[model samples]
Target: MAKIKKGDLVQVITGAKQDRGGDRGKQGTVLEVLKDSDRVVVEGVNFVTKHTRVGQSARGSREGGIETVEAPIHISNVALVDPETKKPTRVGHRVEQVEKDGVTKTVRVRYAKKSGKDL
Candidate 1:
């Protein structure tokens, strides 16, 4: 699975729109990660407009309108942001010990390569 996950803050580092004067260096939370496709939906990024036809609700109320929503972007275009440094960084995994109910176990955790802190 990809290291990026929902709620992770990421910055656009490369891609057409992320180049030159686009959303480059802009950071936002990861909304969804499409692991199978190697893509992700980030908040306030890659917006697309969709027009919906008028329809009835379960209660027959009604619903229809145009809306703008985030579109999926290639995962390679973004990099995780370091919490402490507030800069873009790569992700790395490490094993840590945890104890619960008098039992100790190891778990994998993500950390920022730049800040060297748990992400």
Candidate 2:
């Protein structure tokens, strides 16, 4: 899985939307992650128009109709937002040891490079 997790706030670094001055420096929450393809869908980012015939789905929501939904953006195109600085930052992995009932174990933790805060 990618370092970025669902619900993480991320800002687009490079994309057509960024070039257009709409989502360039804007930050949004990650709705989903496509691990196999290393892609992520951010809330209110990379919107695409879908034209579907009028119909309802089992979910009760209309399945067929023109709707705009967030599209997947490559993982490299976005960076996680640092909570401390409130700016986009690269993710870094650090190993830490934790004491358990009998022994200590090593675990990997992700943090922002800029602020060095745990994610």
Candidate 3:
């Protein structure tokens, strides 16, 4: 599994409108992980229209209208944002040692190459 996890900041990279003129890619927290489908739902990306029907016997119930809501995008479509530079950067993993019970344990850690910093 990759290091990309929920709450990590990410930028949309391969959508139709992403990184377009006057509309740079948006940055937001990863809301969910759809690992089975290889997709993720960002907090505020890939908006879609949702239509709801008005129930009968409701006062002033006009025809149902469509509401726009954020939708899920594929994980491959986003890049992790570097903490230091505040820009999107590729993710890489490295083994680091951590002290536990007076013993050093090696753990996989994610790092950002663009900023040369551990994330």
lDDT of 3 by residue, 10-103 (tens): 9876645544532137889999998888888888787788998876555765667798877878888788998888878888988899998999
Ranked by TM-score from best down, the candidates are: 1, 2, 3
Who is ahead in lDDT, 1 or 3?
A: 1
Report the lDDT tens digits of candidate 1 across residue range 35-117. Answer: 88999999988889989899877888667889999999999989899888888888899999999999999999889887553
Please report, as a residue range, the 10-residue window in candidate 3 with the lowest summed lDDT.
Answer: 15-24
Off by over 4 Å in 1: 16-21, 59-62, 115-119
The sequence of per-residue lDDT tens digits that candidate 2 reaches over residues 1-119 is 26899999998877555556567777899999999899999998888998988767888867576889898988888889998888888889999998899899998988888745422
In model 2, state the lDDT of residue 70: 90
TM-score for each prediction?
0.83, 0.81, 0.74
Native-referenced Cα lDDT, model 3 = 0.79
lDDT of each: 0.85, 0.84, 0.79
Clashing pairs in 2: none
Between candidates 2 and 3, the lDDT winner: 2
Candidate whose lDDT is highest: 1
